[model samples]
Target: MAHVVSKSEMRHVSVEELRQMASDCRESIWAQAQAIGREPKIYLHWTAGHYGQFWDDYHVQIDEDGEIYVYGELDEILSHTWRRNTGAIGVTLLCGYQANTSDLGPEPPTAAQIEGMARAIEALADGLWLTICKEFVATHGECADNETNDWCHEDYGPRTTCERWDLEYLQTDESPAFNPWAEDGSRGGDVLRGKANWYHNQRG
Candidate 1:
């Protein structure tokens, strides 16, 4: 089956506005999740563009200062991931332009962007009734790294495409230099999931 392209255009919204929108659509999203053949997943990404540069491919985008942007409905089938767009929601950080395998470029992801994305993920998880984990919420790099799996198609990983290293090395207190493979237990996706889980627990 051919992948359907997304018609979502990036739209800026205040944090409060985003929350309100999520609350308004929570029931519908949950219903969709409960339906058979529906498995909600969130995919993290980086725009590979300068800060504030928005892309239509992703459903949500986080900016350098932690601002959030919505491109389309959470239930919409977006063209963010290859072959994994069917039930995946795409969230991205607007950074990493001109990034290469050796370096994350002039506009590497910032602390604010990471935090913003985490909060967004938490809200989405709550709405979609999803648990924050590698299987449910994965980074683009992680998915690309799963090339051995049947879900992954084509070579689009750091070692292969060399540009799929979004959030591969994230800045953390233990590893401020953004070490690769999370040698210090601060892999980008792990950090985001940890934060999102904390947020979820706090709500209980």
Candidate 2:
């Protein structure tokens, strides 16, 4: 029988510690997923809360200061995304409260938070043998975009009803590029994936 991990075992950690934790738990997570006959995928999100806020729905969270909080095990299911919890590792950035289409609100995603999430992605992808692509790694907005992805159960996203547009427009210092896949190419899942890929190569 598999050892049961408590859902309440949330812990605060730094970015480096998060990478170490992912490495330490790699084999167990992979074995558990195989035991359950499921493929692991990563789903990124924003809490829509204050910078220091934390949520129990997501397995991992990165705060405005790049502090990481682990809420549950990688293979443990959490109610972060609608209809996509099973075999899904949910990672969220705590920011975007009171955000709108034209505004990112006062507590927008910070550079540290974005880089932290990218590093977390690199660690998790390395542990899970996942490809940093749309099929394996996606944002809540992408999952909500029914037109582009089959992950959505309803018509909602920045391109649709404009709901669940978490991480739609990231706070970046670079000039953004417009693309058909996202409202802006430099602010979508591609950016995170690109950063994660860069980290992977740099570290390798």
Tens digit of lDDT per residue, candidate 2, span 1-204? 112234246687765676676667667666655665645668899988788777778888888988777986766767888876776789998898987666778998889898889989988887677778878788888777743335438757666777777877675654143232544447558788889999999987
Clashing pairs in 1: none
**Candidate 1 residues 34-146, lDDT tens each?**
46354667889987777866676788888899888898786677788776776568898988888765567788878888888888888877666677888888888878867
- Per-model CA lDDT versus the true structure: 0.72, 0.75
TM-scores of all candidate predictions against the true structure:
0.79, 0.82
lDDT of 2: 0.75
Clash count in backbone of candidate 1:
0
Clashing pairs in 2: none
